[model samples]
Target chain A: MKQLTFDVAVIGGGPAGLAAALAAKEQGATRVLIIERNLELGGILQQCIHHGFGLHRFKQELTGPEYAQRFIDMVCRTDIEVMLETMVLEITNQKQIYAINQTQGMMQIDAKAIILAMGCRERTRGALRIPGTRPAGVFTAGAAQRFVNIDGYIPGKRAVILGSGDIGLIMARRFTLEGAEVKAVVEILPYAAGLTRNVVQCLDDYGIPLILQSTITCIHGKERIEGVTIAQVDQDWNPIAGTERDISCDTLLLSVGLIPENELSSQVGIQLDPVTNGPAVDSNLMTSIPGIFACGNVLHVHDLVDFVSQEAETAGCAAAAWASEKQYSSTRIIASTGKPGPCCPTSDSIPFDGVANECCATWGSTQIIIKPGNNIRYVVPQRICPDKKTTLYLRVRKPDQDVSINVGELKRMKHTFIRPSEMIKINLTPELLARHQSDYLDIHVVKEMVHHD
Target chain B: MIKTVICTVCPLSCEVELTISATNEIEKIMHNRCPRGKSYATTEHIAPRRTLTTTVHIEGAIHSMLPVRTYEPIPKELLHQVMQETANINVTSPIKMGDIIVRDILGTGVNLIATRSM
Candidate 1:
């Protein structure tokens, strides 16, 4: 068995892993390596041929490949080693990585720190439990994207999209441009799950109808997709009687949602968050197991790639500091401030002056757990240290106007509107943290009452 | 006449209302949160444009198609016509990012550039 050693070992070389490895190197970590399971380095970005990425970080509207190329090129220019076409078989809490490739048969890599950036996978038809025949035309929106954009084969001449997420809306236009007719984009929710810009540019501009509060009830096909039975649903989401209609189409694409790939994380007994389906982490992005960190879609499904990169950089910097034994044993403080568009932004620099081992020992005893309350769905970085600034990323359970978000008794902020599809960022400053007397922060959202004359 | 437009500047999605006169002039705008929203609604109502992004046929590359986009937004109505013109482009690989595939496509004065190298 050939054994290799690195200061930081990154798993899955997607947008997350790429940014993680680069940040690790730039943070003065020696011997940083990226382990990619795919034959190429770009990952899913290769098939994402649409524009409107990189609006943040780079402040430019770049296509997915172009956004990925910026990091790939930077990684190439550095000493960051890359292992393509290699799959990680197992990972141990002791920081031992067991992986295999055609060239290197059963190799074991030892790392001082490990960063998980495996990303997420699209929800399939089977997950939706759509009662239908196992047909060839049924595919996820991402799979259809790969076939049309990368593989150069349009999935079908006429297609029906089952969700109104960002991917579904993009594919509606893609199918239309490829000389195909998109019958309709049926969404079970009353509002679109994607961004407003996408809804306007992808569907409205194409003259494609987005039917809300309706869902696909059944499939009418044996070998190929013949059509789908659609029905309007009630507030309880159950199909309304006599509201069923059928639309004939050759393809059906499910753009339901995404789930973080956490098989390896759970295999090592890392604590998982039931809401995010990812490892529960603290301010340093470190999982339950010390010296092991998680970021990107593997941490939580992100709406944009720029935020994934920003988050991976945080995990990378933390892993590097952990590998070099530069920070407090298990209580490294990461300071973040302000609101991110849809994700939390890790601060550029936080002076660690006087962060002694003795100082950090008492900080862990002062750690506070963040609890989701009221209309709050979940908040990331489930725990926070009171001595430093921590940016909390959270989502609401429903849509409302004049919403007031409160973080225990320490802080409160008001927003004009808050929706389930959008994540809210709130920064916990040191000033606000000092007022926290409770052992846990119960963060909740409440709609303010309106007054009339 | 009054028309309402959804501002796509950000996720807020403010509904901007525009008052138009008989000769098709915007007389007044209301309900926009930011200056960008007013501009977005004005352009959307009068002369709308969209950045054209699509794939073209390529030979001797890792893939059979190359992703390309107009360097700037082209006229909204000219999108389908311009897409038809780009279909005639037959280029070889060994191209780099920002490489131009078609110059002034369909006389829109917007060049079609490659999104990434094959």
Candidate 2:
């Protein structure tokens, strides 16, 4: 193995890696190398043929490739080095990275700082534990997307997507536009986990029906996917006795969820957040190992690529600072103490022991509990420390109107808005916490408005 | 005639109503959420452009053809004409995604390029 050196080694060439490399250069890093597993530098953005990205960041509705090209062009004008078709095999505690490239064979990189921007991977059928025979027509939504958009091969004429995630929704439209019939988008959860705009623009506008609280119970086919059995699920997600229905289709696409690409991060001894299935980092986005950092979907699942770019910018600058030997002590571990509750940013199976002295000090008990309220899907920061400013994100539990969220002491933030598919963000400060001293935080939402005035 | 248009330039995609006088004089506009929407509606009600993505034959490659799209917005009505013109052309493979194939093919100053490799 040949040894290479750089000031920064970005592990993924997606939006996060591109932004990180560019930001690191702007922050005065001398040498930067970006390693990408794909043949291109855009990451998954390459397969995203839709035109809903870069609205906030670029102020234009650019397709995934267009949005990615803007950054790729900027990186080209810089001194950054991009290595495509390069896969990082291992990352060591000492910031040593081992990678393989067809041309280079085995290569080693030793950098002052490492950025884990590998992004996330789609969770497939095996991970979902779906009882079915392995069929050729079954594909993850991303894989199907690549087949239709990039590879120029139509997966099938009739399709059924099993999850209402953004990718699944976008693919529904893509498949439809490509002349394939999308039968339905079946989601196990009562609400969609994608963006509100996606549900409306990609599905509703295109006339793709969404079945809520439903799941594919079994797959039927021998040589290929011939049909699927869908059943209406109960509150506990168990299929109701007689609600099973069969839909004939040639293909099945899964958009269940995404798992952070943190195998290398974990191999390097970085603490993992089981909830986000990403690396555990502090406010600065630095991982457990000093001088190493992570951002983007690798840190947590992000609904928007613009947010991924912003997070990567922070990680890049922080990496530059760390390379300069800027040091800070994390004497206290503000962990989520107590039984790993359902919303503890960890395992959902863990039982809740409620508030305890050992609860992550970040919670501090004076904190407000931001759980999934009525018609609200899920809220982040299951427990928030009012002492420190925190931005909480929540998804609507269902399609709602005139929805108003009344935070204990704060005036109701209301308007006709919000969808189960979209996540809403609200920032809470210490000043607001001082006024509300309730032991258990209460959140009530009501729909009374027709539209936003 | 009064025209209502949806500005698909951004995610906001505001729906705007434009009132036009018989003499072609610009009149009042309502329901536009932002300044961008107002300008977009004004331009769209008169002329509309759309981005196009289609495939053309590619020779000397692993596959028969590669997907290509316009680099910028093209006149909506001319989409069929542009498609017909490119339909006969064959691009040689080893083409990178975003590599410009025809410079300003439609005279809209927008280049047509391969969207994905063969």
Model 1 lDDT per residue over A1-453, tens place: 989999999999999999999999999998999999987787788778888778777876788888888889999999999999999999998899999999988989999899999989999988889986777899999999988888788989999999988899999989998889999999999998887778888899898999999999999888898999999999999989899999999999889999999999999988788789988877768787777889988998878787788788888988888898645343444312111122222322122111221222323434566778999988888776667677788888888888799999877788877878777878878788888776567999877776645
The window of 10 residues in a row where model 2 chain A has the poorest summed lDDT is: A349-358
Q: Would you list the clashing residue pairs of candidate 2?
A: A335-A360, A337-A359, A337-A360, A375-A397, A376-A397, A377-A396, A377-A397
Which stretches of candidate 1 lie above 4 Å from their native place?
Answer: A328-365, A449-453
Q: What is the alpha-carbon lDDT of model 2 when measured against the actual structure?
A: 0.75
> What local lDDT does model 2 show for residue A236?
93
Of candidate 2 chain B, the 10-residue stretch with the lowest lDDT total is B6-15
Count of clashing pairs, candidate 2: 7
For all candidates listed, what's the TM-score of chain B alone? 0.87, 0.81
lDDT of 2 by residue, A325-409 (tens): 4322221333323232233332222322232222333222233444445665454444455555555555565666667886665
List ranges where model 2 is wrong by over 4 Å: A326-416, A423-453, B1-32, B35-67, B70-89, B93-118
* TM-score (C-alpha, index-matched) for candidate 1: 0.91
- Residue A398, model 1, lDDT: 82
